[model samples]
Target: MTPLLETRDVGKTFGSVVALRGVSMTVERGGVTCVLGDNGAGKSTLIKILSGVHAPDSGTYLVDGEPVRFGSPREALDRGIATVYQDLAMIPLMSVWRNFFLGSEPPARGPSRALGGFDVATAKRVAREELRRMGIDIRDVDQPVGTLSGGERQSVAIARAVHFGARVLILDEPTSALGVKQAGVVLRYIAQARDRGLGVVFITHNPHHAYPVGDRFLLLNRGAGLGEYGKADIGRDELTSLMAGGAELDELAHELRRTDTPS
Candidate 1:
């Protein structure tokens, strides 16, 4: 079977500056593809290309093994490629159910398309059911989304994406700002997405966070590909060191070594 999404030797440039070159990776259904990189490591460029915010200057982007060039994020969304950004694209004051169906509300039947016409009962049920399916137990769907914890908010976004027929879930720094417990909550939900057979692109700089959940690792440095490896081919320590700049860190450590004096 073809991968849910894959990019081949993708390259992007901003006039005189090169942002990405020869970067390639595949996101498979039922697995998490972790894109690991520090700042300025082409993560932003990759996300923009994947979400259709920008087009690659070179190479091909494919969905389901078929070449596709998305002119906008809406086009990507229409193709079942949904991105849940770090900000989550949610209103803090809105209730959980309201936020779930925010832009794409279930319209009432008939010819008249009233602005406020929505199937509230059905929406609430779906919102609740979808959250539950993702192992998120919100006390009440009517409660304001801001009242929930960070992890809960992330779960709400994930469930919302899944409910809207998202075949590929692109998560940007989902665990970056959460506490240990809250981060764990989001990680479990990541696993939940994989179990549900959705191709997951987990973009983050935290190797410790990515190691446990990632099935494949794509390492990037200075806007170039380091390599991509399967879980068995790479371990946590190696992943962390590589992300932290292995030899660079060593040189810095040696340079900073304390000078000893005979006492």
Candidate 2:
């Protein structure tokens, strides 16, 4: 079968500024395609194009080998693409189950159905079951989302996406804010999502975080692709070196040494 999502020579330009140029990569079912880039590497532009926040100025974006230009994020979601951004878009004060069924809540049954009330019982039951199925054991579905750890919060978002029939999950720097232990927790759930046959686009600047779980690595630097390599083709150290721009780092270190030298 065709890859779940793909971009061919995809590019985006904002007036005179080229945000991305000739960036290409593929996300396959049951695999993680890690997109590595630092601050201005055009990673944000690529994510926008993929999630329908913006369209590419050139090249093709295909879903399952069929080209598609999504008008809105809803269109992408309708096509089974779910994005879990860093902020997560969850209400801090809301309960876990409430946040899970936020916009797409089920209506109450029996006597309350005609009155158009929310179905609290079924929503709680389903949300609890789904979270548990994803191996996320929330202590209480009634607890405020803000009370959970960063890793737990990310897990909830991932579980929610999977429960909603998402075929592809795009995660935006999910581990950036967490500690080593918490980051490991998020990574585990990412692998969990992939194991369940969902194509995962793991966007991160940290090669260490990506290397372990990534099936493929696409490195980006200043709006261009360094290269795309399968896990077998690239080792962790090499991946880290490329991402850190080893040559540049070496030059900077040399300059610092020169400044500190005695005449």
Candidate 3:
């Protein structure tokens, strides 16, 4: 089977600074590809390239076995590539339905060819139905989105992307700010998206969170490729150690240890 998304020898640089180097990976349909890294790692850069925020300086991007270039985010969206950043991107003061249909509102039409514009009622009904399909039970679609929990907000964003026809979903640090239970809720939704046949690129620093849901893992350090491993080739502890800079961490811990002395 062809990968839903693939990057070959992808690299990005800013003036004299390199943000990514010869990075390559694939996200298959119905699978999760977890990109793990700590601060200053190239995880953000990789996602930007994938989501079309910035085109790679060199190398190729392929979607469904065809080469393509995304000049802007709209181009990526046109090709069914959607990204949900850490911020959830919802207007806190707006109603759930409003936020759901913010940029892509449905249109109202009569018999004539040039008949209509934003259909508020239809948008609300469709938003409610989409959320319901994802098993998200909202008390009131008219309530402010800020009224929902962090997890619920994230789930709403996911459902919005899926509803808008996102074939490849890139989630950037989705669980970084949530409590354990809330994070679990988001993870379940990630799995739900995967099960529904969307290629998921889950960018996170937490291995424990990634292990259970991820089908493949790509490790990065300091703008360079560390390695990419499948579930069968890696374990949680190994992933953690690599992200933490294994030997460097061990050396620091050893040097900081206090010794007991006798006179």
Best prediction by TM-score = 2
C-alpha positional error of residue 246 in candidate 3 after TM-score superposition, expressed in Å: 1.7
Q: Give the TM-score of candidate 2.
A: 0.97
Worst 10 residues of 2 by lDDT: 109-118
Q: Number of the top candidate by lDDT? A: 2
Clashes of each: 0, 0, 0
Residue 121: error of model 1 in Å?
0.9
What local distance difference test score does each model get?
A: 0.93, 0.95, 0.91
**What TM-score number comes out for model 1?**
0.96
Write down the worst ten-residue block by lDDT for model 1: 254-263
What is the lDDT for 241 in model 3?
Answer: 90
Candidate 1 regions exceeding 4 Å error are 109-116, 258-263
Tens digit per residue, CA lDDT, model 3, 1-263:
99999999899999999999999899999999999999889999999899888999988999999988889999999999999998887899999999999978887666532575778789999999999887788899999999999999999999999999999999999999999999999999999999999999999999999999999999888888788899999888988898788999888777667333333
Q: Once superposed on the true structure, which residue ranges of model 2 sit more than 4 Å away at CA? A: none
Each prediction's TM-score versus the true structure: 0.96, 0.97, 0.94
Residue 154 in candidate 3 has what lDDT? 95
Q: Report the candidate with higher TM-score, 1 versus 2.
A: 2
Considering TM-score, where higher is better, how would the candidates rank from best to worst? 2, 1, 3
